[model samples]
Target: MITTHPFNDDKLREECGVFGVAGAIDAAAMVALGLHALQHRGQEAAGISSFDGTTFHDHKALGLVAGNFDSEEIMRLLKGEWAIGHVRYATTGETALRNVQPLYAELASGGFAIAHNGNISNAVKLRHDLVRSGSIFQSTSDTETIIHLVATSRYRTLLDKFIDALKQVEGAYSLICLTEMGMIACRDPLGIRPLVMGRIGPEDGGTVIFASETVALDIVGAEFVRSVEPGELVVVSGGEIRSHRPFQQKASRPCIFEHVYFSRPDSIVDGSSVYTVRKAIGGQLAIESPVDVDLVIPVPDSGTPAAIGYAQQSGLPFELGIIRSHYVGRTFIQPGDGVRHLGVKLKHNANRPLVTGKKLVLIDDSIVRGTTSLKIVQMMRDAGAAEVHMRIASPPTMHSCFYGVNTPERSKLLAAQKSIEEMRQFIQADSLAFVSINGLYRALGEASREEEAPRYCDACFTGDYPTPLTDLSEREQPNQLMLLAERVGG
Candidate 1:
C-alpha cells in the first residue's frame, strides 16, 4: 500500500497548491520558488506551464519540487513571461503522471493551461454528459473536464467561454489559468477554497501573482494585495490587472480548515494570520478543557503553535516531550511487517527524560483515524508517563470533506464511529477532549457559529455542507473511491 507521511496519516490532507505569475521576467523560476514554499500543501507531484506569446511550454513530474525543477536544464525549457504551477496530492484521480496538473488544451481562440486547487463535486455527472456528446479526454483528472467545457462552449470570446464553462460546474475551486493572451485567476462562487493576489513591483510595471497562500508570495518577494473575492475573476493582460464578477454573487464561506491545518503557519488567509488563529484555538481549548499536568507537550510541527497557547493559557510548563525526525519521507521501502509497525517511531519518538513519571498533556490539532493517537499514547506510557491526557484544538471531525480535502470515509473516522469516552478508551489516554464547535468559532473571533449561515465551512465538524452534494445525492449507494475512479476512466 502507498502510505503518506507516517505522522500525517491521521490528519486531513489538502489537495494541492497553485502559483501563477504574469508579466515577470523568468516567470517560471519565480513560480518554482513560490511552489517550493507552498509544497506542504501537496508533495506527490509538481508541474509548471508557461506561455510566451504564441506557444505554451509545460513540464510535470511525480516528485518533490526540488527533485523535479532544481536543474537549470529543466528551467531553461520552461521560458516565458507568464507561468503557472501546481503541486498535487491527488484528491480525485489515481497517482499517475497523466493526472499531474496544469492540464493544458488548445482551444478555438488560443492555447490555455490551468492549475486548480479544489475538487469539482459534479465532475462525474458532467463528465458522463460530455463523453456522451463525443468529448475525448486525454487525462483522468477532473480538472480536464474544465478544458473540455471551454473547448465546446458556444461563446465567442475565450473569456466568455471560460466563464460559461465555470457556470456549468459545481464545487470548490481556486483556479489560475495561463493563455496566449494573459493569465486568469478566480475563486469558486462560495469561496470554499483560497486564492490571493499579489504584486512583485510597482502597479505600473510589476508582476501579478496568484497563489493558494500568502507564504508563496513572501518567498517570491511579492506584496500581497488582497484575497481574490469570492466569485470574482481576475484577468492579467498586457501588464494590467482587471476584475470581473462572472458568477451569481453569494455569501462566501471560505474553508475554515485552511486556518486549522492546511495553510502554513506563516501564511495569512483572508486577512488573518494562520499561526495566530492556531494559537487562539489552543487557548480556547485550554479554557474549555483544562487539565492538571506536570508538562504540556505538542505532537510536533502542526501542533506546536496551539500547544504554546495551551501552555500559556493553562499556566503550565511547556516542554518538548516528543521529538520528530525531519528526515522521514512520505513513503519508505520497508522490508517487513515488523518494520512497518515501527512507522510512527521512525517519525516521532518520546523524550524519555521529560515524560518519565510526569503527568503530561498532549496537544494535537485534530484526530482522524485514532491509530496514530493510540500509538503515541502507548509510546508515552512506555516512556514512564504517570498520566497522559490528550487535548485537540479543533472540534471532532465527524464527516468527510468533499471540497478538495483527502479524507477517509465517514465510517473510518474515529470521531464519527465512537463517543468521546469511547475514543479516550480506544486511544488508551487517561483523558481526551476536543474543543467545542462554538469554542472554535470564538477562537476565530466570532461570537459563535451562526446556526443558519456559518461564516466558514465547518461541515466536517457540523455536517452542514454549505453546498449541495448533487453527485452524492444521485447515487443509490455512494462510494467515493469508485465514483472518482469511474469519473476518471469514463
Candidate 2:
C-alpha cells in the first residue's frame, strides 16, 4: 500500500520524523520501511537516500511514502549498508517532490544524504554568506544550507565538514545522515529536538537505529539506547558505534512540547510517557480551574484523554465536545486568519445539547493566537451555554518557537500581547487558567534524563529560545523552494 493511514492538524507540521540504519543489507529499504512507521509526524512527502561507499542514491516524492514508494523502487535505489530516511511537513519550502527529503549532495570523494527535524534560526545569515560565495543551490530547503557549507568547507573529512556545518547553523534540529563511510545522527545544541539511538543486537548480525522518536525503534524490534544528547554527534559504521562531543553549549533543554503534544503516545520522549504527562496536565487543570459544570468537554482528538482526566478530577461527566473529520488532507485550505479568524467552524462545530445551558469547562491543547479560542468560545456561547470557562492543558505561548510548531511572529501571539485578564475579556470567556510551568514539568513525570524523563525547552512559553532567530520582519514572504533556501539556507 502506498499510503498507510492518515493524520490530523496537530499531527501535521514542518517538523518531521527521521529514521536511519547502519550495518544492514538493503539498509535504504529498511530505513524507508521504518519511516513508514513514523508517517504520523509528517505525510506531505517522503524520501530515502543510501550511501554504498562509492555513491549516494536517492529517491523522493511528494506523497505518503507508502503510496509513493514500492519494493521495486526501493530495490532499484538500494546500494548501501548505511541509509537515512525522511517524512516531511513543509515549514521552509513548498510541498513538492523537490522539497521532499533526504536531500542529496555530491562531493569530490563521495556524497551524503540527510533527513532533518526542526528549523534553522540563522538561515538568513547563512544563506546570504553561501550565496555570495557563488555556491549554487537546488531545492529550497533549510537543510541545503548545511550542504553548501559542507561543500565549501576546507575540513579534511566529511565528519569534520558535518561538524563545521553544525557550528554555522543555529536552531532546533535532530539530524540523521548517511555517508559512504558511516551513519551519523545528531541533535541541536539545546536539544530543542529529539533523536534517539537503538540497536537490534551485535550478535544478531549487529544493527543500529536512529530516529526522531523511540517509538519507531520499538516498532522495528530495536532496543532503546540513550538519546543522542544535544550538541553531541554519533557515527556508526561496520557494526560499531563511535561518539563525538565537540560542541557543548548552555543547558540542554529538549522541547517540552514534545511530551505535551508533538510525540506519539507510545514513544518514550527523553524517557517520558507523552500520554502520562498530558493526563497530569488535565488533572491539574481540573484542580486549578474548576467550574460549576454539568460536564467536562474536550476539544476532541488530542484533548480526549485530558478531558477524561479533567472529568475524573472534577467529578464531572466527560463528553466529546468537538468531533474531528479524519482524512482531511494537508492540501485542505485553512481559511485565512484575517477574513475568518474563527476557522474552527471549518474544522469543528458544537454539539449544542451536550453543552447548551450547562456550566462547562472546555479543555484544549493550547490557544496559540487566540483567534481560534475566540471562535470556540463564541460557538459555546451560541450553543446556549450558561458559561464558558476556557482551560488550556498547557501554558500560555508568549514566545515565538524557533523549533517549529508554526508559531507566528511574537506580536501575533495573543498571550504575548495581553495579560491573563485581558485574554479572558478578549476571548469573551468567563475564566481562563493555564497549567503552571512547574506543574507542567511534574505532569510530564519530571525526572532526570538518567533517572527517566529529561528536562525540556519551553522557549515559547518562557522566551528563552534555545538559539537565537534572525529578525525577518523586513523580509518579504518567500515562495517556491528558493525563498526558503535564500531565507534560511545561507
What TM-score do all the candidates reach, one by one? 0.96, 0.85
Model 1 over residues 310-415: C-alpha lDDT tens digits?
A: 9999999999999999988887766787776788998899999889999999999999999999999999999999999999989999888889999887878999
lDDT of 2: 0.77
Clashing pairs in 2: 2-66, 2-67, 3-67, 123-488, 126-490, 127-490, 140-481, 254-457
**Runs of candidate 2 exceeding 4 Å displacement:** 1-14, 52-55, 70-81, 333-353, 381-384, 445-455, 471-490
Residue ranges of candidate 1 with Cα displaced over 4 Å: 1-5, 473-490
Q: In lDDT terms, which candidate is top?
A: 1
- Distance (Å) between predicted and true CA of 200, model 1? 1.2
Q: By TM-score, who's the top model here?
A: 1
TM-score of 1: 0.96
Model 1 pairs whose backbones collide: none
Task: Give candidate 2's TM-score.
Answer: 0.85
